[model samples]
Target: MSSRQGPVVHKFGGSVLADAAAFRRVSTIVHSEQQSGAFQHGALLVISACAGVTDRLLAIAQAAAAGKAEQAEQELQALEQQHLGLVTELGLDRGELQEYVRRLCAELAELCRGIAYLGELTLRTRDAVLGYGELLASAIVAELLRRELPVPVHLVDARRVLLTDYHFGNATPMIGESGYLLQKEGVTGALQRGEVVVTQGFIGATPSGIPTTLGRGGSDYSAAAFARALEARELQLWKDVPGICTADPRRFPEAQPVAEISYAELQELARFGSKVVHPHAISPAVSGEIPVRIRSVFAPQQPGTLVWHRRYDAPAQPLALAWRERCMAFRWYPKGNSPLAEMPEIVDTVRKVLELYVVAASQGSVLLVTGPSTGTLEELYGKVSFLPHQFVLACIVGNEPSRWTWEALELLRNSDAVSAVWTGVSPVALYVLLEESAAQSALAELHGWILHTHALQRLRL
Candidate 1:
């Protein structure tokens, strides 16, 4: 039987796994964690597809579907060089690293070949092709861990361990079903025996062994699932930035780091659009009431942000300001004037047709969506979806949100650039739908009022 001891699940993002040097740095971090007895039960490392690798794989698939053989081959060669370059830089034996490199290259080639022959891309085939990225990345990370770390490195193919339904591209793992396999397959046994396990995040397999992905940025979700399956002590996400900040530092220069946050606030920030962490990344941890830490890969010494299950009273000020760009807003009218009770059906219909999510909803009419939008969604929405404005979603995420919620809505309503403004969906955060062209200036003015003017006190430790 698997031990019930709490383990540590560490998820490393693509930005932290870009090159050979990054892998070395992670190895050092892992070493320190082990030496400090951080993983009371054991450790499991979940890896992403490395920086820019996913985009490249998707491009290769697109080129293949478009019958751009030369371009596809060119991208393939570049990808090969990039992985092989890492192997060389890490000073690994060519034959050893080639074992992984050759297999992945061959698999990608066959998938691309099929796409070119078919002249189209299906969601199933898309996931099958993209799954190779994380598999190859995990293989490299495992080898690096073996050579650099002081523990036994075991590569546990997540496709074999993580059981999921046939959702293909954005599949959901059956955690309970996976628990049985984990015990029977020695995943838990190995952890109990003190081997450090390395697995590819975001990739899973159906009962028939077909490959699938848990959407982009699902590595964190994968780690959380693994942690829940094992009843781990805590989940740690290693990122490039210091931690979860008031706002994205790149977009908001004055954004401050949040030392700690509650699970409720974190989920609100994620659903309303905060890239610091994925929306479903901590689901398992939240279910088990496990603590999670978002720490910096570059600055390991920093404590970073901690998320707990405890409730914190709403402070008078908002916690942080958040923003999501390229949001698409849509308004719909039913066959007859409908009551708000029709929301569930409308939401179901929209979900059936598009990959986008409803971020803000009011009177069962307007929906603020943010996700991969395509011509397919456009065609479906063209039926009754009118206005279909594009905007930037900016909000103040906090315990007790400021009166600025109404104030900002009024401010944006008066702005010549803001075509529409939304309020009341979430009490803690105010949602604004800005005209695409004027989004920047509108965000600047709002930020200046709420943040720069000291209206909301900075949320920190």
Candidate 2:
């Protein structure tokens, strides 16, 4: 739509809202921001399901689909108790909130019964069942914020505003239509009245009113969409980690936090394999030119990574490293008189329907990689002859990756850990293929070399 008005959109994932105490922490953060005059027009909070709830829901759905109604019901009861227990722990009024939770659970129970009767779990039905996690979580969060904040806090069903296509498991938002409905449905009115609006993420509805999800880890994308629609001043993604790091800090404890990153660099990192943000989350923000702050709920005082159009005063060093393990590489060789012109079409098809990453391509042959989650290999069995081998895909992300390509390649070659290396996949990344046994060592060496080289460049400057 138009440019930013004033409101800031805040998104919290499951890791940040793992418990009742975490909810209190979130409420406090929102309240502090409000007190600090951070919500001028108002603030919109987008929330994902609590930790592990979506997985539990998926299990219940599978059980029901397999005709194990009793087992599904038991799991449903356990889930209901978990939410109700959160209410109890929060000391929230057990009157209407508890009843509301019970009502949602009852609806889920009905869906379980339906699946059991049909002995099938269609993608649409699974999307419907999965959406309850967000519905339940947002409801609880709204109630907590209502009790904790002095300002009027309103809970809105995101499905009423975020209209999407018919893709049940991984729906795409219709931005223009969704924006119109969002303002038409009173979200703008509530914000104008200085009210805090909270909504569920990762779930939307078709134009005909069927529930759909934005796929796994789609909450970040949901928040970005809302931010773009509302023209928010900034989108703050609150996570468990301190901020986006040079590498996954848990795996590489020496990984340093990046103070700033460009949208292109962050997108490259996410596409390669960073878990801090979803791969599709950046485009909406980029379209709006809105800055996104990757913050940590645990370390609210520390300034996190600011992703924007450009990085001011930041060196053009490798920003981060991302890797996908358990990857399968496929190589296709050109037959006698056959030109490899069709190779691009095959790669496009595989990329569209699966998690395909092209490592290298040439006139004589083509090499591609797919992650462990892609199970559609049979579809390409006879179409293009491919020899599959296990490998790891590692990428070094930077603003000017070409500047450091030779250094990275030389390091990889010297280490003798990487099996192959390729650039030009994107302007911001360099990809290297490694055997599973060598991936860890190669990555460690690359990370250390990047840090050391950056330090040397800074000293020379």
Candidate 3:
């Protein structure tokens, strides 16, 4: 009666396995599938650390960098205790896991000492510190599976598998060879034998043997990469929520889940802060044309959002309603009076510096928004010899776009809060610039406009 046909790759987020009960639930979930013959080809689970672990690890890094040795030690102790508590709760005998936890704690203490003594936390060092969460999670889950499940489970350090350059943070995969190594190195055989293998996400070792991490939420991308590597039939992301809703359930009470959506649309939603899938994760899977499922741990039976490559030509309605937050729009002008000549360098500098997805760019202007870090933007603006006085960045996303700027100004809008009237640059989105205080009012006003405007109500789904 089981519907699952072949090998499946499942990723569990931090919230899904925060403790023993959650881990047990996961075990049961995996157990049921294998028993019912749902996991016919086998399964691979990528696990994240318990909720709040990464934040704590980050705090430890920050504190150590700031010379707060005492503070860092306190936080490190708390993390150790948390892991120890989980082990005790699971009622497992103190064995390999205990040793691993002890080793991790010692390494963390050394990391703190290094930070305090060196007085600088480089990107490489910080990444090494941050990789602990995924490692701990992977280890614990592997141990748990061994204790509870009937299948043979193997633990593989992704560092050895997902090899990459020494980028430290935001490392890109050395795909061609990494995929080959993983396939040849028993990944294919393990799945063939119906053994469940566990691997860490986000953290991978560089070619130079230093720890490197795939920026935040890199786990999802890692899972997608793995699926593509193995050519798995389905990639399931077990999240805390049911599926991608029409709107954020917190923001819109009447929000409904989207049963299925195209990868392109999902990418747009992710860029606009949908939280449905990592915007970066879509590219690889879409190119491969593999179906990615976003399911909820709470409702194991419900069909969640499915991400695939499909042309959405449905009736004029929004597939999902999403908006970006902490969004700031930069309005900049070239220092030179000549419009077209200086455009390339100006745009290139910003691109090199920020590495941002340009929502709008022109010969004399630019607009940029980042949901993550602002380092790139800061670097570009700081190093580029732009005529500083020519630029004025505004929070244009989600604001009422000015109607009069259509002809002369190159308006670039990326946020959903802007009404259709303000978005003159494109037919899809309206971009605006405003302060944080006015964002709510801007959203409300735009909501009214969007509900009534022919532009906003039209959905391409």
Q: State each model's CA lDDT, in order.
A: 0.76, 0.84, 0.68
Task: Report the number of the highest-TM-score candidate.
Answer: 2
Tens digit per residue, CA lDDT, model 2, 116-187: 999999999999999999999999999988888778998999989999999889998888888899899999
lDDT of 3 at 229: 73
For model 2, the superposed segments whose C-alpha errors exceed 4 Å read: 1-4, 309-314, 324-356, 359-393, 409-414, 418-422, 432-442, 453-461
For model 1, the stretches where C-alpha displacement exceeds 4 angstroms are 1-5, 117-120, 271-273, 313-316, 323-394, 402-424, 430-461
Candidate 3 TM-score versus the reference: 0.72
Q: Candidate 1, which ten residues in sequence have the lowest lDDT sum?
A: 452-461
lDDT of 1 at 285: 72
Evaluated against the true structure, the overall lDDT of model 3 is: 0.68
What TM-score would each prediction reach against the true structure? 0.75, 0.83, 0.72
Instruction: Estimate the overall C-alpha local distance difference test score of candidate 2.
Output: 0.84
Q: Which prediction has more favorable lDDT, 1 or 3?
A: 1
Off by over 4 Å in 3: 1-6, 311-317, 324-461
